[model samples]
Target: MASVFNAVDSISAELATIIQLEAPDEISVTKKDAKIEELMVMDQSLLQCMGVSHASIESILRTTLKYKLAFKLTGARGGGSVLTLLQTLLSATVVDKVTAELESCGFHCLTATIGGQGVQVCFGGSS
Candidate 1:
């Protein structure tokens, strides 16, 4: 269990680094850590609602821990037009990169957009 938490932390750090590297200089990225209690509330019905398959849901449930890492983007310094365009491109790139990294680690990830400038990535499975 402790190891699971450590792995989650490591993955989160790597993801942060990836985002920082990919994001433009004018974009500010903030990371929010999800509570385990929040993760625990995710049940089969909820996953099903998210369009997860039965098999995948079962596998997800069996995992002892789940994690969510949110990346919020705000323009630090940019014109309105340039900021909007940069945010749009960064959002897509972050999602694709994060999804690939998590899936390669055997975790199932769900991405949701937030406030038109942020992405919340929820993931769980065996480490």
Candidate 2:
């Protein structure tokens, strides 16, 4: 939640600049309130196993493909093992980016390790 809030604040700031430049006093700040509400709608779509698998961490890379930031993972695949779809790699990147984002939002991500069970996530935040 803190991550989301922080993202909202940052994005809203950027958008506010654009809005003001385009419309000036023509519109009110009420427009941003809708965006704030939209960001609060959490995207909880996922499965338990995929959350921890190394193969699932490349979601960010997959997103890059769609956005033509395909430029990021430049060059071609040669030798060694075959490449996997961008989707399979997205999970880890998502976790990493979200962790940093949440951290930047003033939240501490509590990670607990369990024998044979793996790392469990404990979500907590401070405003």
Candidate 3:
């Protein structure tokens, strides 16, 4: 499923961040960036082989972190299910901004989170 591909993308992004933090020199940073790009491309190819369209896969792989989080909250289909409902309870302002962005891109952006004190909606009607 797309979730598996998404997980690979997440792991790759986290690894890139870790590498950037720990890299000692410009050469190391360049190498790390190349490796990350290669891995991401391969992951996207695998997703395409598994039936996801190029557009959907690209949107999933190339978007900002907030968009990725929004995808997770809204589900790949962008439907607001019980899981999405629970996630919205712990929302953030970035989620609101990205939700709008995702919507403009034709994906549904739900109000949600991975969990906690629930959403306070301090930043407008982000919830």
Candidate 4:
């Protein structure tokens, strides 16, 4: 939740800065939209620092295809992976082949699942 708030706040600040630099006009709206896009790119770059595994997956996607990819922290537990948006239409086979190639190159991949086991709780009086 904090991260979501942070991203929104940062984007708001950026839009403000862009608006302040321009006169009130349609061009100002365009400029603010551009700044939002820029913020998305910066957020992707920040994802690179999320840890080695995350970085590796992001690298794989970038190397495999030309797509608008963004990595976001998803779910209440703050977990997620690279979210791909198509710039151009791609065949499903291409995605499958890329996944296979990544696996062959030794990156583990998993489907997103929900409601998994949680940490076991032993309710004996604390020491």
Candidate No. with top lDDT: 4
The collision pairs in model 1 are none
lDDT of 1 by residue, 9-72 (tens): 5655654554445333333232121221222233223434445344533443433223222222
What TM-score would candidate 1 get against the native? 0.23
- The per-residue C-alpha lDDT of model 4 at residue 121 equals 70
Clashes of 2: 13
What tens digits encode model 3's per-residue C-alpha lDDT throughout 8-119?
A: 6686687557444544666765565555545545554554566555455346445544343322221245523211221222347655665566567776544433224554
Question: Which run of 10 residues does model 3 get worst, by summed lDDT?
Answer: 80-89
lDDT of 3: 0.48
Q: Relative to the unseen true structure, what is the Cα RMSD of model 4? A: 13.3
Model 3 earns a TM-score of 0.33
**Cα deviation of 4 in candidate 1 (Å)?**
0.3
Model 3 CA deviation exceeding 4 Å by range: 1-21, 54-127
- lDDT per model vs. reference: 0.38, 0.35, 0.48, 0.52
The estimated TM-scores of all candidates read: 0.23, 0.20, 0.33, 0.35
lDDT of 2 by residue, 1-120 (tens): 566556545655764554344222323333433332232222111211124223322453343334322211111333111122222123566656654654564544443321233566
Better of 1 and 4 by TM-score: 4
Error of 4 at 23 (Å): 32
TM-score-wise, the better of 1 and 2 is 1
List runs of model 4 lying over 4 Å from the truth.
Answer: 1-40, 48-58, 65-81, 85-89, 111-127
lDDT (Cα) of model 2: 0.35
Off by over 4 Å in 1: 23-127
